[model samples]
Target: MEWGMHGWGMGLIWVLVVLFLVLGVLAFAKYLIKG
Candidate 1:
């Protein structure tokens, strides 16, 4: 209920957070591979 109060906003934030984390991991892996 508390998380649903903001509806799409909460969902959007979570999607962005997950995307950022995945990108971060990929970037780190890329950097490691390059080095």
Candidate 2:
């Protein structure tokens, strides 16, 4: 179990990816509603 091998940077990247995906879905839903 190496500490820096699976470090906070990688986890932060994944968190951002998920945040973007959630925001994308919300934007699409808003577009559909407006259309």
Candidate 3:
């Protein structure tokens, strides 16, 4: 049970990190296009 919870927490963290990175890249691309 403990290991399952730990793995789930790590997965959630990675998902958030990936999502943030994708958003950052999209924003950067938009800025580059506008500039």
Candidate 4:
């Protein structure tokens, strides 16, 4: 298990990507509901 700083950064990026995807889905749903 040689995972160091690089692995940590990758994990953080994955979390951020997932967060953005969830936010995008919620925003689209809200737009649909409003329109």
Candidate 5:
């Protein structure tokens, strides 16, 4: 049970990191276009 929970937590962190990176790229592109 503990191992399963640990794995799930890691997966969630990875998902958040990926989402943050994608958003950062999109924001940078938008800034360049507006500038």
Candidate 6:
């Protein structure tokens, strides 16, 4: 049970990281277009 929970936690962290990266890229693209 503990191992399963740990694996789930890691998966959540990875998802958040990917989401942040995608948002960062979109923001950078918008900035480039505006500038």
Each prediction's TM-score against the native? 0.78, 0.77, 0.89, 0.89, 0.84, 0.88
Candidate 4, 1-35: lDDT as tens digits: 67999899999999999999999999999999999
Residue 32 in candidate 2 has what lDDT? 100
Off by over 4 Å in 4: none
Q: Whole-model lDDT, candidate 5?
A: 0.96
lDDT tens digits by residue: candidate 1, 1-35: 66565988988989999999999999999999999
Question: Which clashing pairs does model 6 show?
Answer: none
Off by over 4 Å in 3: none
Give the range where candidate 5 is weakest over 10 consecutive residues by summed lDDT: 1-10
Q: Give the per-residue lDDT of model 3 (tens digit) for 1-35.
A: 47798899999999999999999999999999999
lDDT of 3: 0.96
Which lDDT tens digits does candidate 2 get at residues 1-35? Answer: 66684778788889999999999999999999999
Candidate 6 per-residue lDDT, tens place, 1-35, comes to 47698899999999999999999999999999999
List the RMSD of every prediction in angstroms: 2.2, 1.7, 2.0, 1.3, 2.2, 2.1
4-31: candidate 5 lDDT, tens digit per residue: 9889999999999999999999999999
RMSD of 4: 1.3
| Cα-based lDDT for every prediction | 0.93, 0.92, 0.96, 0.98, 0.96, 0.96
Indicate the worst ten consecutive residues by lDDT in candidate 1: 1-10
The 10 consecutive residues of candidate 6 with the worst lDDT sum are 1-10
Instruction: Give the clash count for each candidate.
Output: 0, 0, 0, 0, 0, 0
Candidate 6 wrongly placed segments (more than 4 Å): none
* Model 6 Cα shift for residue 25 (angstroms): 0.4
- Predict model 1's lDDT versus the native: 0.93
